[model samples]
Target: MASKLGVSIVAVLATSVGVMLALALGLISLSIAAGIFLVLLVAMLVFHGAAMDFTSGLSDSEAFQKAVEEKEQREAEHEEWEKEYWGEHHPDYQGEEHH
Candidate 1:
C-alpha cells in the first residue's frame, strides 16, 4: 500500500544518509554524529505523535462533555421511571404498601 511505500522511501533515504556520512567522515566526526542523532530524534517524535496523538488533551474535551450530558440524561430518566413505578411500594416508603 501507500503507507508501505512511504516507509520504504524514508528507510532508503535514512540509510543512504547514514552510509554517506559514514563514508565521508569515517564515522568519527561531530557533524555527522549530530546529524544522525537529529534524524533519529525526529523519527522518534514522528512515531510518538502518530501512535498516541500527544496533543496535550485538546481533542477529548468536547467528547467528554457530551458523554457526561448523555449519562446525566439517562440517570434522570431512570429516576423518573423509578418514582412513577415503585415510589409507593418501595420498602423505605414511610406510609404504606399496596396489597
Candidate 2:
C-alpha cells in the first residue's frame, strides 16, 4: 500500500516536470497542459481506490492475519532485547521515570 502511494507520487512529480518542460519549449499550450494534469490526477485517484480495495480484501485473509501477528511478535521480542541491552550496559539505569 505504501509503495503504491510512493510510486504514484513519483509519477505525478515526473509528469509535472515533463509538462513544465513541454510548456517552456512551446510544445504544448497552458490549456493542454492543464488537461493533461487533470487526466493524470484522475488516473492516480482511481488507482488509489483500487489499491485500497485490494488491501482491504487482503486484510481479511488468513495469510495477512498471520503476517501481522508475526510482525507484532518480532517487535515485542526486539523491544525486550533492547531493554535487556540497556540495563546491562548502564548499571545506574533502573528503567524508571525521572523528575
Candidate 3:
C-alpha cells in the first residue's frame, strides 16, 4: 500500500514534468495537456484501488502467514548467531542485543 502510494506520487511528478515540457515545446495545447493530466489522475486512483484489493487478498492468505512466520524464525536464528559470535569475540562487549 505504501509502496503503491509512493510510486503513484513519483508517477504524478513525472507526468507533471512531461506535460509541462510538451506544452512548452508547443507539442500539445493547454486543453490536451489538461486531458492528459486528468487521465493520469484517474489512473493513479485506479492503481491505488487495485493495490488495496491485492493487499487485502494477501492479508488473509495462508502463504503470506507462513512466509511471515518463516521470516521471524530466521530473524531469531540470526540474533542467536550474532550473540554467540559477538560474545565470544569481545570479552568486554556490553552492547545492547539486537531487538
Candidate 4:
C-alpha cells in the first residue's frame, strides 16, 4: 500500500539524517557510519519485501494458498507421528483428549 511505502521511505530518510548528523558531529567514525548505513539499507530491503508481500495479501495468490494448505497438512502429519511415538514409548501416555 501507498501508506506502507511512505512509512518505509520516511524511516530510511530519518535514519540517513541521524547517521549524517552523527558523522558530522564526529561522534562516530566515517567507517562506522558507513557500516551502519549499509546494514540498515540491507535490513530495509529485506523487510520491505516482506511488508509489501504481506500488504499485497497472500490469499489472493493460488500458490500461496496451496503452500498454506501444504504446511497445515505437514503439521497434522507430524502431530500424528508424535502421538504414535509417545504411545509406544510411554506406558502411561494417554491421548491428547485426556490432557
Say which candidate scores most in lDDT: 2
lDDT values, one for every candidate: 0.68, 0.85, 0.85, 0.84
lDDT of 1 by residue, 12-93 (tens): 5787677667857786576766777677768766765664553444357777898899999998897777666676567465
Quote model 3's TM-score.
0.48
**Model 1 Cα shift for residue 26 (angstroms):** 29
Q: Could you give the candidate ranking by lDDT, starting with the highest?
A: 2, 3, 4, 1
Residue-pair clashes per candidate, as listed?
0, 0, 0, 0
Worst 10 residues of 1 by lDDT: 90-99
Candidate 3, poorest ten consecutive residues by summed lDDT:
90-99
Backbone clashes counted, model 4 = 0
Ranking by TM-score: 4, 2, 3, 1
lDDT value, residue 51 of candidate 1:
46
Poorly placed runs, candidate 3 (over 4 Å) = 56-99
Please report the TM-score between candidate 4 and the true structure: 0.52
TM for every model, in the order presented, reads 0.34, 0.51, 0.48, 0.52
What is the lDDT, from 0 to 100, of the residue 87 in candidate 2? 81
Q: Candidate 2: lDDT over CA atoms?
A: 0.85
